[model samples]
Target: MKSHYSDAPKAQPILRHTLSVLVDNEPGVLARVVGLFSGRGYNIESLTVSETEHEQHVSRITIVTAGTDQVIEQIRHQLERLVPVHRVTDLTVQGESIERELALVKVAGKGEARVEALRLASAFGARTLDATVTSFVFELTGSSEEIERFLRLMGEVGLVEVSRTGIAAMARGAETI
Candidate 1:
């Protein structure tokens, strides 16, 4: 006999979601929002929050997560129900948006290796922030994929460390979130 669960519908594909939340810029507001995710056992891949309107005392939180469509919808609903949250926009589904991340990549090498690193950095449009005979610190900003690719190349050479400034996303149109 067939197993009972075999007849169940297929699972939805896991997809990347970028959620933008507008909230009151108040103490403990961020903690409460993050608690909701941790309490629910959801994973947050990237989070960037900052006050966008100083006079209005409103902040924008951008979170990148991976989940199915249903789970994403649930997250949006829960965020809306929070007292401090004024709006929740799923930039992934809303419309075209600009998403970018900044990274400070440190590579240590000398001679030919250092030369190659500098060449590659120039090719990728990375700017050299600090440099010495042995190590170089480069600042790069671009899509996540581009940053990853650049890091991989640096690794092949002599990647020492990397500091990434999570993701910052905003809708492209004139509409405010």
Candidate 2:
């Protein structure tokens, strides 16, 4: 006989989600957080951590991942149970949150290519963080999509390398979590 669950339809495609977690900034906290992801076989696309309130000894951990609605909920629930995690906010469900990432892109080229890189960077409002005879490093901050677009354009010009500070998000209004 067929299994009872065999007729169930497959779940929907996984959508990108951003989660902000407040935790104690004590040592080994980040490792524990990261370990939870790895141990559970979850994939983290973007991760950033910073001390939010020094006086309160709280740090914010922002993580971006792709998962179905149910999976996202499960992740959030699990995070909430972590000892060091003070709070977990799924910005995707919380509504109207501001999300941004910072990237430093290095492009190495000469002559017209160099000029083109500069022009493109200017168009994207990227600041020149460093410049050398044949290379330039641009610092940019924007939404993930905007960063992807900038990287694509830079690839055409001569992208050498990139370092990114992953998504940091917060709710728009008076909501604090």
The TM-score leader among the candidates is 1
**lDDT string, candidate 1, 56-91, tens digits:** 999999999999999999999999999999999999
Score residue 34 of candidate 2 by CA lDDT.
86
lDDT of 2 by residue, 1-177 (tens): 789798899878899999999999899998988888899899999999999999999999999998999888989999999899999999988898999899999999999999999999999999999999999999999998999999999999999999999898999998586
Give me the runs in candidate 1 sitting further than 4 Å from their true place. Answer: 1-7
TM-score per candidate: 0.95, 0.92
Clashing pairs in 2: none
- lDDT for model 1 comes to 0.96
Error (Å) of candidate 1 at residue 139 is 0.4
Quickly count the clashes in candidate 1: 0
Best by lDDT: 1
Q: How much lDDT does candidate 2 score?
A: 0.93
Query: Candidate 2, after superposition: displacement of residue 87 in Å?
Result: 0.7
lDDT of each: 0.96, 0.93
